[model samples]
Target: MESEMIVIHAENAPMPGISKPGPHQRYRHPVISVEKRRLGALHADEIRVQMIYAGLCGTDVHLMESDPQTGYIRSSAPANIPETGRVIGHEGIGKVLAVGKNVRHLSEGAVVTFESIIVCHYCDVCRKGQFNQCRNAKLLGLEKDGIFGKVVDVPAMLAHDVTPIIQTDQDLQAIACVEPAGVAYVACRNTRVTGGDVVVIFGGGPIGVFAAMLCKTIFGASSVSIVEPVSFRRSFAAQWADHVYDVEAFFANMPECIDVVIEASGDLQNINRIFRNVNANGRIALLARSGTSLVLDAMDHMITNAISIIGSRGHLCGAFNDIISLYKQGRLPLHQVVTHILDGTDGFMRLVGAIDSVLYENCKVLIRFASANGRS
Candidate 1:
């Protein structure tokens, strides 16, 4: 019974907009369980994966209780749930218990993780190696079943062998965080950030905090300044930035010019602030995923100072390797950034609640999951 695996199902889940209060216990109420099996060839090109830890994302929160059904779930799932089961969660790290016959780049017992966006090779973007921007992208947990399940069958192409990453296997769940860090890595690379550049970072969330940390560590910026109103996240920024302040203080202290601005909070209002705070010629690297309509002043933003804002997508290929190298080389101190770790049982709900608390409190949190099966 120790290795027993099971599949839990959700027949009906209300739209995130309609779900009251939170995401964990709502939307038909998801359940976590286990079953015992050979764990091979569960689906075509699907290799069974034993999930160790999966982080609950802010997007999951928006899908859980926020208004307007947008994001991954709204894009893939039926607005109403008389339709089919909904499996949610994308930032998951686990071990492969077995592999399908056709599987390559991975094998049974390999530790692995992957991005959620699955692109059809036939798409024009995929054909051009811009799969991240593919029009036909199908998100994993959003479009189909996600990695929240104890044992999942993942496409081999997406699952990179992460076993070599475990410097010490004792802390398996901490390694799961590589996915979010990978996100930060990809965002920072969008522009040429280097030493002596004055930068402003908005949205003291995990992404924003990492952006500040990376800008400090990798780029050696002359002065990395972060603008966030939250206390906890502001502290995270404090550890890295030469100057960290609330929105008001950030404006009061800054000149009318910054070299680069990284915005992690999805609030459209932040855009106006970035435009106001940065120098005439500057770069704006945005990591936020926005949904609501945003109004822009074309003349002020585009024509005058000639500012450039680049929208950051998910990880690029080789990004995970780059993040790992940073960690190994002591460039990124990922351990200090982890503020909270919750269990897999109620991880999603708990994490969503924490994110909301941090929005007000200003800190970062991650979910950590481990098996009852003793470490091998």
Candidate 2:
């Protein structure tokens, strides 16, 4: 028997008495609606997944705020409202509810984590194995419906099997973080971290912490440090980074001849600070998506120091597989970064309303859609 599904579509509607000078406009509420529909058959290469846990990201908070500078929210709608009103989330781990006839590697009831971006294999970048920079990329949450809802239809290739890493449902929940971990891995790859090098990460957010973990655990950095402003995040970062410093404290005793620097804060001031600290020929990887711009000191940093500034975007989807393998080997401690888990739909709304405030204190927040016994 076919199951029933609810498909929420957002219509074009602007708030009253609000006009924006820039391209971004403030929307008072989250743009989501629930509509009734029957579960449709999957495409030959697609799979139907029932979401178990969806992680709330900083990007979601920016979307809720209608932050004019955030990438996904600013581009969410032509004006202020979304066209599809699709469920809003990009990071999740789910169980395969059904698989299409042509789906070869996956089976119903199998647990998986999906890569949020579905790239066109025909693109030049994708052909060269740089799918992260694919010319034509269709994002799951932004360009299409996301995985926040009960069930989602995803390309079978985008879903990676997590059975190897997941020992219990709790481990499956941690898989919701594989996306950010992959992004951090890409940033570390950009910096070309080597053993015994000193690495510094700016910001104490989930990405910042995960980048620090990869630098220490995978790249074998001699020392990993974090520069964060918030006391709560600074304390949380201590578990992963060897040294956690408040911004002022870090600047006071800033290390010299740093091997690699990762700027994940999205704060423009970090660039200048990087210039002062990074050694000649050291690599600095910019990993933030905050729609902010920066002006670099060319003479002192670029020409004289010969510092290489690498702009890193999303991860190669295949990187998720590597992350899962590492997690299975007990190298990636994703669960350590999960600070809170809110259960059910009401919990989801509560997060949407208070996410901006929570970002200062929490590392990663997961919304548990299913109970421990697998009931929703």
**lDDT by candidate, in order shown:** 0.64, 0.75
- What value does the lDDT take at residue 86 in candidate 1? 42
Q: Candidate 2 — which residues are off by over 4 angstroms? A: 1-38, 67-81, 371-373
lDDT of 1 at 274: 55
Candidate 1 local Cα displacement, residue 41, angstroms:
5.1
Cα lDDT tens digits for candidate 2, 1-376: 2332222233333444756422233333345434443457678889988778888776665555544343224332212235545556778898888899999999988888888777899988888988888888877665666677666777887888885666786697678899988989989998999898889899899999999999988989999999999899999899888899998898888788788989888786777766767877889888776655677765556677788889887867467878888888888878888888887566766665565656776989887776434578
For model 1 the TM-score comes to 0.81
List CA RMSD, all candidates: 5.4, 4.1
lDDT of 1 by residue, 248-310 (tens): 886666766688888777766766755766676778877776544455665465567788878
Error of 1 at 357 (Å): 3.2
Q: Best candidate per lDDT, number?
A: 2
